[model samples]
Target: MHLQKDTNPALNTVTAYGDDYIEINKTRHQRSIYFTPEGQIYDLGIQSPFDFTTELLQKITGVCAAAKSPMDFLDHAAPRFENPEQIEVLLIGTGKTQQLLPPELLHELLNARVGVEVMDSQAAARTYNILMSEGRRVVAALII
Candidate 1:
């Protein structure tokens, strides 16, 4: 029932994630969430995560849809430099199951220089919070 508030203020932290929502700074969000570096939390229409660059977040929007295979979502994280290194890693939460990443999608991200990790939403939420606390350039596309 308590969120240990950190003295230093950063982007809101993921306190918890439930069946269909994510908690940030102790505020329980019961719907899909779209959070940018900016303070406000908007409805992503599917809810997703972090001081994350909006550019990166926007890029993720390009591939964040509910699909049986991640291939359904496209890779848009490639930067103009055309370096796949634009994003170091992307964490994907595939609902309640640990599904395989689409080959095409995985290939695109690898070619574009991004690493991908697939897990369930709960695990992803925990991982995301850990990475964010470490100040890594990480993002998550979550489904609850």
Candidate 2:
């Protein structure tokens, strides 16, 4: 058997998390956040799942959508991705509990071919780390 090592030492990983905060790469964030496996992190400023609105979701879709893919995340210009293969699914961490979002809210993402996974913040964090380690194109929006 062969083992492949992650070449990027700076890749962000969820280190610790609690009901009120999440630690990524050893830094703590009390607010919600969005992160990619490549170490790109952004504060989402969402205090709860209710703060994760359709507009915010649209922005996320813009960030993750492939340049050549359908413009399904609103009418804004889609962000170009260096590696289209790096984006697969989006993990939504619904704060302290798992919350189901309306299917219509995710319709655009689905049309763009991006899968959605919704879970509690803690579970989402763990899943994000695992998917990232495996070099899957994954993004996480964790509500802390």
- The most accurate candidate by lDDT is 2
Error of 1 at 89 (Å): 1.2
The pairs that clash in candidate 1 are 33-47, 84-112, 84-113
Which residue runs of candidate 2 sit more than 4 Å off their true CA positions? 1-8, 63-86
Error of 1 at 25 (Å): 2.3
lDDT of 1: 0.57
Task: Give Cα distance to truth, residue 55, candidate 1, Å.
Answer: 14
Candidate 1, residues 49-134, lDDT tens digits: the string is 22223344436633332224445347543332233224556777766667655455465455555667878767877777777677
Name the best candidate (by TM-score).
Answer: 2
lDDT of each: 0.57, 0.76
Determine the backbone clash count of candidate 1: 3
